[model samples]
Target chain A: MFEGREPIYQQIAEAIRGEILSGALNEGDQVMSTTQYASTYRINPATAAKAFAALESEGILRKQRGMGTFVSDGAPEQLRSSRRQSFFAERVDPLLRDADVLGIGADDLARYLLTSASDASSATNTDQNNA
Target chain B: MKANGTATIQGYGVQISDLAVRYGSTTALEGVNLDLAPGRIHGLLGRNGTGKTTLLSVLASLRQPHTGSVLVEGQAPFEHEVLMENICLIRESGDVIGDVSAADALDFVEVARPSFDREYADRLAHSFGLDLSVKPAAMSRGQRSALGATIGLASRAELTMFDEVHLGMDAPTRQKFYDELIADFAEHPRTFIISSHLISEIEPLVETVTILKNGTLLLSEEADDLRRRGVTLTGPTALVDQAAAAQTVLGHTVVGSRDLGPTRQLTLYGDLDQRSLDEAERAGLQVGPVPLQDLFIHLTDA
Candidate 1:
């Protein structure tokens, strides 16, 4: 669902990018048409089309003459690299700054992250063992 | 029922060229020009008595322009039966005749509008939780509005318009109507103009937004572009002022401030570059968005 902030089209583009990078959508997979996206999400078709156009410009999606839009061959890789570049600025940097304000050092955060990761793997292992 | 009749206007493009309407000395609309493409939902937004109804009435051929003209599907829609038949305009009361039951009113559309489909009307009515057996006079305002919505949608004219069609419906009902409209439009695909004071209610549903101010065309643009006309910047007063100094600030206020530091939120109108936004963000300022309603109010304020 789209919130009204920062234009819905931009969010749509970001969402498609996320989907491609997360492997939910594979390269060469036919994505939803603009109208289909609009109907499914209940957003304006124009907004949906604008997002698709943006994706096309970024070489993420391609539109065939008769057929619908398909994820470009290098879409997932392209998105991954682009997202990787921004991940530090948009996500990691903010978290690090917030932790700094809370008087949490980088080493402490790293230690916490290690503990969280071990806990997650152990939880998965327990599920597998139970199964 | 003019079934085997004349022209069937296939396209739903609307062109209002210098459309001006007046009721005697009182000027209703002046030199209003708008170009609405085929099969797009347009939101006609305006303040009270800002000629929203006048524009729609002119398009519906309910009242002719005293000075200008309106073209739907490349021809003027005056007494042109073919064009008129292809256009359905439902006003705020949902256009249901008071004397008849909702079912009868819908059935009447089937007789009058060659494009009206009874099964579709029934389905929409059921989805809207409307009882077809209830007369418009006896039905609640919400039910009547739902019936009107059902009729307007089921008619499926090449150009179907609803003027404040959500009149007395609750928030959830209006939302349901919008959802239904989106689903139906995807399947049918026609030009739909919805006039409403509730800009946010219809903003997401529309592709194009035509705003009227004091009976004149203020601005018309795609809703996607129109919604970006304003941006909100929130930060410390000094930094916010420095960043917003060169921009056109429509409104600004101090949302949070201490004796030592004052944090301000500035609503800026017009285009802004990404570089400026990045600079502001780097200065520890949070960039936000102006809601459609706020923008409309700001743009239309005297």
Candidate 2:
């Protein structure tokens, strides 16, 4: 379901950005029409249209007029870089704050992050070996 | 069916002014003014006996207003032949001929409604799993609701309203109806106003919202705009009071203190930017969004 704590339009924009970043929606590929999204998600058409307009403003999506909207050519890299910049503010700050609440120092938090990253990579390597 | 109308009529805008209705000594609606734009779904939200049905009934010409005026698609509706024909109102119950088969009832629509599309109706019936062979009175509650949805969607009138038409549907069936409504609206753009107490369920389905309380209009705005009306903060009473000092406090409710301090949660109605949210967070207060339903309940506090 597209329903969430955030506004539906913001959620819609994030979904499209996720798709673009993950390469599910390739560069220059046409996205669903507003009508299609509205019906598929059972959301208001204006909300869907609002999401599209936001993506267009961010240059992550472009319009083809009669053909409808499409993922922009530079959308993947654009989204990746933008997400990377906001990652610290939107994600890492909250993690650091939680660690601080638990009486963990910054160095200890950094150590924890390192170990978790290595553990994650090792798990992925094991899975690859199994495959 | 032979008809004397054009192929399609665009969606109609609804305008009402000083409209009032009374049932004997009781008032159902009073001095209500609303403007519903064409080609968008408007959610008419209210508690029971809030005049939602009374307003829709008047628009559909089921009854005349005791005072004032109503204009549908820019023309008066009372006894206005063609204009009345263009409006369809589907109720929660008792709109159908109970003794007739569902198919017969739909057939009746074909003859009575100049714009009825038989194939579309049949397709909708199949989609809804409607057993058209059974009489309306014999059908289950859910099936009757499905029939109501079928007619509401397939009618294709210029202005179609559903007054809690999703009442008896199960979750999946209601989702199906919502999807069908958006799809049908896309395929044939028209004005639709759905009245329901299920605010969250209908929130995403509507672009415009009209909330009623005690037979009067409370607030009417775009659904998105309405959702952005408030942010609720819960913390120490002094801190909460300080944070909400300049804002419009919709209401405040007492909450448990964190550590022997008097804590009160207050909901403020109106816009608050991200900086304000951050300020609340910095002040150690928990910030939460006020959903449309909560806003409606507060705005229509009774």
Candidate 3:
């Protein structure tokens, strides 16, 4: 369940963040306790606790004093915003670099993005209509 | 039994200072000083003949250190009645009554170890598919290992050590054993020292890691810290060399580099700061983590 290359705690934190971003976990919903994470992932509880601590420090999760850890209020929005802040550097810059390496011009990339964006929106609309 | 009456018995911490042990004329361990914090799963790693078993034996009171003091939870474990009971060491050979039935072995441990839980042991045995009617001597090697694992888990000793006990079990059985260990540890928080050659298998389960090299302590660190300590860089040879110049390169040759051409990969053993990471990224050098298993091999290479 965990990759060996990076720290398990960091991976766990990223997983929870991904869950929040994907709407799998909602604000105010109680996340799995460290014990649950430990058993499910076959990892040490301390490692899970460390992940929770990192999330807590980032206000992505909050502990309710003996009850359990819950997704912080507006956690999804916070995560989305932070991800939005890094999107250009983490996503677009790499895309641009790859395009440059492929000898693709900026205009061509722009045209491709414009077409892809419309296609993605139309796909979303079709899914909404099906729902 | 007095300790068992308590709902929660915290695991014992260990303090070893200037410890040395000798077997006949050969010295097994020397100048060893280590402090293991309580209530964490620690991975003891080493190659063959590196005093891993010797250190565990000393901790379990099976053998006394010839030179220095060894303390468990504050008091010396050697010859101490209560401390000895709290410290259980399960070896790869499965330390149980071979002649007695598997059920009877549990009964024996229940009598000797105050913390032994019969109900839990029964449940574990069922999960491991260990037949209680069969004697350990009659069981296969894997079954014997399962029996040993059952005793170790059910013992619930404050400080439990498994000295390569999982080596006998096959892959799926080892997986089950690790899962059970994590689950049980969650319910009952205690110190665990697992010494095994399967570094990658146990990497996720250990909070702290201690590596021994030929009768001496090589490195003792938090598992997470150790993971971050070794970084790998792979890219253009000039870029990789430039990035590695500022860091502590682990070895002379690149780990997986072939042909010594335009691209090269180097393993470095040290913490890489954020600035250096950003620099490596800008330079088009791919920075990756070194697995604990690889790091162990590199550090313990003859």
Candidate 4:
């Protein structure tokens, strides 16, 4: 459900990417029909179709001759690798550099990360248990 | 479709680069760049006095951008007669000669616009119950709008732009305009740019939207992406903050029984995870999507 902000093609690309990342759309899962997506989302079928086409181009999704689009087998791992590469470039490296500038020792950073991770894991477990 | 010897339909990408213009002291547009594709309806969105008219004028080659160029098919629109002929810029007033009857104006348009189909214009006028003998000055505001609509539909310009042509029309007329516009586009594909303040009303027609604030392009986004990108969250400030952490916020306000409680209406940009969405709902916040109008106001308001 995007609004008019960035180019719709890019937005469509991101929507498909989100679906893949969430695992709700698994490998070989048939992507939503473009026409159905268009009506349900109240967007132009052409635009919804553009998103699907982009995914197909990226090798994240593939289309059958008579059937609809299905998630590619390698899509998950490929997306994971690309995201991981971007994560290091966009986040991890900058964070480490910031820590170095702040004169935080490696050991100190390790402790902080360990503690935060533990806390997050425990919170997630507690939430899971509650659920 | 060819109405005369010349073809009315010619699709081309519009690439406006470093476009700047000023009207006396007012900066109508400044250093604007847009790459609008062919055959898609683009919404030029802005508040009152935000230079939407100026940009459209430049695009249509009615006026030149002071510093840059409007490119139709990679050529300057002002210099390209064929490209200029393919654009129909329908203004709000649709100011035709007062003395000329509606039929005369339509006839003139048919001759002036190579693509104007006389038969189509006549059919439309007949369908709308428009009297050909009625001069524009003698007609009601709605009638004038109808005439403009007729011109727009009949022009069949590759790039047909409507700038608030139905502002004063009734709701039914506006709805009719929307339906007719969509149906016409399906039959005859072209690039349509509609500049309107009625965001929610015309949101369905716009495939992509470019928003301007103080003559600057703030956002150029697809309608679908924008819907997915923004969310409205309401709850305690702490809970809201927690849910909205790491998210870009468009705007937020307070709402409660006291009218001055914790922040209740928070418009966030970026997708919220399932946990975050659930947390927001659990915090007694009515989490939902914000409309484009609200987002526009939030983004443009000082």
Candidate 5:
């Protein structure tokens, strides 16, 4: 039973989300059919259908009537925008308060982030070249 | 603590305390304490002999708790008309009048429950292809179960508890039940506690889970939190074991040896980042996460 700690549909949504984030599932890519997901996950078809329906509502995926569900083009961009909107209020402000408590300034954090971003971009390029 | 009659209390949830029920020397429930909130779907799960039924019976006041008090909306439920009307507990075996037909049973429900929706009941009966004239004794087990389910849903009780009521149902019918349950909840929000052994099957319908193990409440965690708290790592036995030494092993299997098989599987109650994944892969390991059932079984068994 997939009855762990969390609503089951959220888990299904996150699984598809992970695929999308990792580029395994590209925008406009056909996702698993509802029946396919149900059988693969051993869940009721209705449950799997709910998850897909939720993604459709969020505009991450769209249904094609009898054709099946497809990931909406620019879904990754939409997801990123939505997450960033929440991140500043939910995470950055708290981090800033912690920084104030620890006597860390904005300049110090900015420098650190800049260095990290450069390193990450270079690492990604190296990985792509290797692949 | 005072025993009030059922009709006087409303909006409050069901409560049980120091509840102990014993059959001879065997204790079905031992000093258990639980408070079921209203309007949310709660999941009750435990092993076959671990007293899930006993607890529900006591909460519904169908059976008296030997040593403690049970309350529905702050009133005793046994023989209490108002509270009984607001509560429906569907046991594993359908609880219906054996001599009465399905239609008669629905009529009885209409008299008993103030919130009973006649149209909904009729629709459900028709959808299930249940004959209103057929007595409970004549119907198949699945049909009998459906009759009970239909009554439970259409009753519109403030608190509804289904204890594996769909066990006799076929896959398609069961799926229909699951969807209808949610659809009903959407139209009218109420407290629903569903107990079933098929965790993966009905996982989507549950909001929170109360896990029981060997008669003790093991954990009551939000489903999402549990999913985020664990992972599965498989690879070389030595490396996998070493990595998982500091964590809990929910389950494991011998997929293969050093070169060809999955040497070990580890479940950790925390997140593993890409770096951790890379480290594991470098050590010739495969990493994943445990599903809910695996997590439940592992946690309960321990």
Candidate 6:
């Protein structure tokens, strides 16, 4: 699950962030302990601990004295806002760069975006209607 | 499972200074100095006859260094009963009782090593598909290795060193051994110095890496730091060459330039800063991390 160029700890922290953002791990939910992560992933417990420490420092995960680690309250919302804050720079700028390389103007990119957005909404609407 | 209470015995830290070992006319190791911090898995990597085994032997106190001093937990291990008892070294040769059944061999270890856990040993043997009733002499080479792994794990010594104990185990058995090692280590943290040629397989399990080259200490550093130090850049030959000019380029290869216009993959050994990485990405260069195995190969290349 952690096949990445980045350090394993960073990958682990990113994975937890993804889980929180996807609503798979709700706020206040107890996460797996470092020991569990170590055994399950076959990684050093110290590496897992480092990941946990980073998350704790970022306020994404909080440790209760002796009870284990849990997702900090409002972590999901906090992550959403921060991700939203970086969305344009991290996502759209890259898309625009690729478009520029392809010689596609902003107008064509906007048109394509609108088409795909509409298609996505229509698909969701179809699912709702069927339900 | 109840805590063994031996958790209080934190792993032993090792300090080796100017260690040298020789066999008559041959110098096995020279001027080796290293400090292994407590309670972490250290990967000892080197090619054949690069003094990997000799270093381990000195640490295990099987053979004294010809010069320099060695300390385990701030005390010399040779002839030091307490320190020696806490240090266990298991080699690929399966240094267990070959004439007796595996069960008896384990029983003997339990009696010998104060911290040996009989239940865990039995569980490990079962997981590895080792028949306890069979003597080591009658068992397959893979089974013998499994027995060695079982003894090493069950010993639970403060400073445990496995000198390529994965030698004869099949792929599945080796995987089982690794899993068991991690699981047991999580419960009971201790120092582990694992010497293995299977660099990639042990990459994730090791936090520290020590490489030996030609009877000398090459590099000893955190595994993550070493991983970050090596970067593989693949792009147009001109762009790759331009970007890698200031870096320590380890090796390069040109492939599939017929259709893609002179592409080259350059493996550089140095920290490529974030700005440089970003620039490379913007330039459409595919940058990848060098696997530990590849880095080892490059670093120890003769």
How much is the TM-score of the A chain of model 3? 0.82
lDDT of 6 by residue, A1-131 (tens): 76666899999999999998866888889999998998888898889999999999999999998899999998977888899988986678777877898999999989999999999989866854753
- Residue pairs with clashing backbones, model 3: none
Task: Candidate 6: give the clashing pairs.
Answer: none
In Å, residue B265's CA in model 4 sits off its true spot by: 3.9
In model 3 chain B, which range of ten residues has the least summed lDDT? B250-259
B1-302 per-residue lDDT for model 2 (tens digits):
22334555458899999999999999999999999998889999999899999999999999999998999988889898887667899999526778999999999988877877889889988988888999989987778888888888887888999998888888888888888888888777789999988888888888888988999988788876777666777888888877776443434332212334587777777665556567766656777767788888777765
Off by over 4 Å in 2: A1-6, A65-68, A111-131, B1-10, B234-267, B271-274, B281-286
Candidate 1 vs candidate 4: which has greater TM-score?
A: 1
For candidate 4, give the DockQ: 0.07
Candidate 5, TM-score of its B chain = 0.83
Q: Tell me the tens digit of each residue's lDDT in model 3 across A1-131.
A: 56544688999999999998877888899999999999888899888999999999999999999799999998987998899998987678877877898999999999999999999999867854763
Model 3: residues with Cα > 4 Å off, grouped in runs: A4-6, A118-131, B1-7, B248-256, B259-261
Model 1 lDDT per residue over B1-302, tens place: 32233553334899888888999999999999889998789889999999998888988889999887789988999999988988999888677788888878887889989888899899888988888888899988888888889888988889999998889988988988888888778766778999998887787788888899999999999876766666777877888888876453534332222333487777777776656777787657787777788888878886
For model 5, residues A15-95, the per-residue Cα lDDT tens digits are: 888788767888889998766675566554556777898999999999998787899988977876777887775567667
Model 6: CA > 4 A from native: A101-103, A118-131, B1-7, B246-260
* Reference-based lDDT, residue B290, model 1: 72
Provide per-model DockQ scores: 0.44, 0.43, 0.60, 0.07, 0.08, 0.60
Question: What is the C-alpha local distance difference test score of candidate 4?
Answer: 0.76
The candidate with the higher DockQ, 5 or 6, is 6
lDDT of 2 by residue, A61-112 (tens): 9998678899988888788788898787667877776778789998987887
Candidate 6 structure lDDT: 0.87
TM-score for each candidate, following the candidate numbering = 0.84, 0.85, 0.92, 0.66, 0.66, 0.91
Of the two candidates 2 and 5, the one with more favorable TM-score, higher being better, is: 2
Against the true structure, what is model 2's DockQ? 0.43
Docking class of 4: incorrect
What tens digits encode model 4's per-residue C-alpha lDDT throughout B1-302?
34543564435678988889998887899978888888888899888888899998888877878797778767888867787778888888565666789989988887888888788888877766678899988887777877788899888898898998886677877776776676667557788898888888787678888988888888887776666666766666776667666353433232112223755456665554545565555445557766877767777877
CAPRI classification of candidate 2: acceptable
